[model samples]
Target: MAKETEIEEKNLLTRNEFDMLADTYQIKPPQFFWQANTYFDTPALEIKEQGAALRVRTKSNNYELTLKQPASAGLLETNQTLTEVEAKRLMEQAELPEGEVKESLHPFIGDTSMLQKLGTLETYRAQTSHETGILFLDHSVYLDTEDFELEIEGSSEEEVRKWLTSILTDHDIPARPTPNKIKRFFTRKQELAR
Candidate 1:
């Protein structure tokens, strides 16, 4: 009975299924796309400044920074979900000076660019509980202008690393690649147990 209850309580949603539901109901995308995965981990970080002129370095290490503008009035708490217009309103309510707005286009999902790049684009792919097919993202971008991370949906993390390596290496940028946190869970847990 306990095992059955656990299974029932642990129902998972897949990426495509979730996306379809979002489209059908006109629900805004969840703030943390990575939540769809069993575990979320980012192995590499890229640091770039606004204006595309310079990359920020922390003692020779490049770290990515993201800045987000909320559309609603007042500060949007972490884990808060907001529509695009609401996010914009939040930004204005914060009384921050106006900044540049950019556009991003997704190759697979119609020729539309709902993707926004404020600074550095941190890209990735991962499996979701909703569908068998993987979310194929050409790239997921993170903006340094905002204080948030861009959780890109990809078919897998390996695919994401390949894409990131290609783009950064092409641009003469070096990155520090790390493994997913899930893979290290056992190790970390065992260490703690000791």
Candidate 2:
């Protein structure tokens, strides 16, 4: 398992804006890939209520489980690489993985066996390097809803924020309040359930 703090900024974009930016930056084929993220939480949504999120992502033939919690810089992320067997067990059975990820989660979810699959979000992502940071272009779909977004992750939060602002201003794209994918998914799930 690996642990680190994530520092990133995000902005919602229209499909037209996404395409225009891609063309302008010459972001082509090889830079894009698809990923599927499956989220999990307790029946009472204890994880989210505690301001934490758990997810297992699949890309190509690889799977990884991640736990994200509020942190000083951005979010503290604990990741664990998983085998197909392990991933299937967690996704299908709500079985928590062993090791650091489990240890880190115990404080919040005493008995992880209570965790259950919440929902899934799939995204086609394209990435490029910029002076301010690594820019990620994502087109995501979840619960029959779709969205386009841009994210910049860098060492300096101030620089990334400034750079993102400049880009939005230059392109005439209004920065809307874009909730993170997990939040959006959870909200949609609640909506559909009702």
User: Which number leads on TM-score?
Assistant: 2
Instruction: Give the backbone clash total of model 2.
Output: 0
- Candidate 1 lands at a TM-score of 0.21
TM-score for each model? 0.21, 0.97
The lDDT, on a scale of 0 to 1, for candidate 2 is: 0.91
lDDT of 1 at 37: 12
Q: Tens digits of per-residue lDDT for model 1 on 71-105?
A: 23221111223344534433333211122211111
Among all windows of 10 consecutive residues in model 1, the one with the lowest summed lDDT is 1-10
Runs of candidate 1 with Cα error greater than 4 angstroms are: 1-30, 33-162, 170-173
Q: Candidate 1, after superposition: displacement of residue 190 in Å?
A: 2.1
Go through the candidates in order and give the clash count of each: 31, 0
Which candidate tops lDDT?
2
Backbone clashes, candidate 1: 31
